[model samples]
Target: MITANPAPEAGTEARTGSSPVRAVTRRKKRQWLPYLLLLPVVVAELLIHIIPMLIGVGMSFLELTQFYIRNWTAAPAAGVGNYRFVLQFDEASGKALLHSFWTTVQFTVIVLALSWLLAMAAAIWTQHAFRGRGLVRTVFLVPYALPVFASVITWSFMLQRDNGMVNHVLVDQLGVTDERPFWLIGDNSFWALIVVEVWRLWPFAFLALTAGMSSIPAEQYEAAAIDGAGVLRSVRWVTLPNLRSVNQVLLLVLFLWTFNEFTVPYTFFGKSAPEQADLISMHIYQNSFVTWNFGTGSAMSVLLLLFLLAVTAVYLLLTRKKDVDA
Candidate 1:
């Protein structure tokens, strides 16, 4: 001790001091281990989704066809020519595209409005405590639980003009009309498609709104009641405010899904959809697979994707601005 503690061995001190640095390095490695473990998943996603999406985008710029099915790389370059053909609306194909786009817009709007309203009402009604509420909720979800193909096909059968339940009830029993209505053909096809879609989709909205309603505190309703707010007033003020965020996201998702919907219409009307109910998805399919114009179809697909992205971005921006203002 009197000899300055043997001047503390330099190597010994260095070795002890480096323990913490080693531990920190190991901790950093541990932090990265999870991501490393996720590498396979990321690779799979890129292969399955991102890679095909990129290929589709590239194909949109090329004159790919059934002829190039075996060797896509050899397809000719299009240089936005397909895009111009789609947007110009001067030719028969372009006019059909424009018409399909408008029809999709109208169909989406109608379905979204009806589905949201019906779901909101059902959600609010079910929120109140009552006997057999659980049973009712389960029953409400039956339509959603059914397989889409089965449900749509069943509806198609029911909507048949001859000996169908719908026509039988309206024409035979109710006497609403003297003649059987051709629900699957003519302008009535549009309304028939809407009915089937709404029946299939409303349960999804109901489930979403129900989940949202559960998170709301009972205190808000009590406070509103104290202020003499009736059921309608309380819903308008308290419930709607609490559900605003949910509604915004739900509405957008429904709009996108309905706009891109194919299964219901396809299963209901088959490959040749009525011109009145011709959705963009069916239109693209007819052009690509039926007519063997993969190039133009790819271009339309790209345009649809871009349009959805733009619409989503604009909607989010506007909503964020409104939230900030609020």
Candidate 2:
């Protein structure tokens, strides 16, 4: 069946003016590959993150019931109700907003200050002629290596009311106290949280500062030394100033973490519920979980988010956003 043999395939295509499948394939690849590669991430983000956030935004302005059955079916708009309620929110929330704000502030400031101070000291120490400086630096990382939950438990045990290591050391071992210190008592819990918090997070600061110190160009410090800049002068003029961005970013991030952190305090002081230690996060839990007031609880969450956003924005603007690196 010599039926025109369809010419040769390429020749037939050329003659008949049909585009080859390879061209179609290449065209598809050129037109769609990038987007196809991007599709998974876009889909994942929409499903996992974007949808939840939109739901939260919608819920923040709604009065949906527990099961979200749409009791009124009006799309549940609260307009500025949730926001206004939060701005004037007081009665049930107690001093929770204030307490959480201040405690978070206290925790963040101490962690930042102590972390940088200790880190800087250790960094400077390492730069000197010390035996086993590497080992010492490695040892300093033990606390940081402990997971948060384990660390919190360890600290709690140490700070417990009786037989705690801190009390044992300060009283029996050192003769510093007549009796065991009540570290977790209502009166002392706030400060106790602070102490443990600082201890647990200090290693982070130490590591960062140490790395920063090591990264400092040796030539710059050598020049400073040649100009008669002493240790303190070099740190103040060169080291600290150079660390500005890293420090700022760490401070803000740590503050946010502390602000929203719930587990440690919840585990340590729950049932006992220290008034001073009741941070906004805990308050949110109480309202949302304990009291099952989802509306008010969601309101609290929205408020806390707004507060953190504003605070972070203001801080960035004042310290970082406005500064030119020059």
Candidate 3:
């Protein structure tokens, strides 16, 4: 016959059961710790970005102008009047806004194309280890690392019509043209803006692309090589496919930054950008500050915010779907 087992002590059973409970408690504490640390950042973001954006959205519905500048809250409400006026298209203000929108679209497209192409080329070139590679990479980053204000100001001075380095080089040294061209004025200003923007932005793109490339496995490239894939072929089949995630992020960020660019245009053309180069940022600024029409400006800003949000959402959705499918 088998002997009966002894019953476990209550204290022993309680201690064994409590162990898991204690572990779970500790795990919860661990999970909450990071959030506790992030509390300050969350608060700061709410204060700095969210609050002001809400206030601006509110201001969009108001008849706030220079008359009520001293007391914005006391301004009369317009109740969507500002939005209606901006979207009327037939009106002068609407026409100006539409023109600026198209200008910004063109500017953003060219910048994205040029910046990505240059960045991609540079990254691919640097992918193969070679002499002076470090120096070349450093040179590429110089434009990105330079102070925006100082660099843009220098560009402004260099772009001067007379007695400028650009003109000097073209007319005196290279003799590309008989007369000095007005780089900071007329249609040339648009091209000048593009050159400066591409020069400034491509380095950052190169940095991002290089980082993406580093994460790609060398064996994959070797395998491609064994399959008779050359440089272009490897990039098409392996490099780009691997870097799809990086390109998605890079292109979206570049698009947003280029679209909202203010400093380059402001520094290049002062308060008034030429009509051809009148980007939406300067347009909004002129409407808000120069005309002292804060209500209209706020409306335009809200529209822009909505547009960017929509674009970002759509892009993320499409990219996520592609990722899932792959």
The TM-scores of all predictions, comma-separated, are 0.90, 0.79, 0.89
Question: What TM-score does model 2 achieve against the real structure?
Answer: 0.79
Instruction: Provide the global lDDT of candidate 2 against the true structure.
Output: 0.70
lDDT of 1 by residue, 39-97 (tens): 99999999998999998888889887788867888989999988887788888989999
Please write out the lDDT profile of model 2 over residues 87-146, one tens digit for every residue.
563644445555666776676676567766776687777865578988987888887787
Residues 35-54, candidate 3: write the lDDT tens digits.
89999999999999999889
> TM-score ranking from best to worst?
1, 3, 2
Clashes of each: 0, 0, 0
Query: Which residue pairs come into collision in candidate 1?
Result: none
Q: Ten residues in a row with the worst lDDT in model 3?
A: 1-10
Q: In model 1, how large is the Cα lDDT of residue 88? A: 80
Candidate 1 — which residues are off by over 4 angstroms? Answer: 1-27
Per-model lDDT: 0.89, 0.70, 0.91
lDDT score of residue 230 within candidate 2 = 97
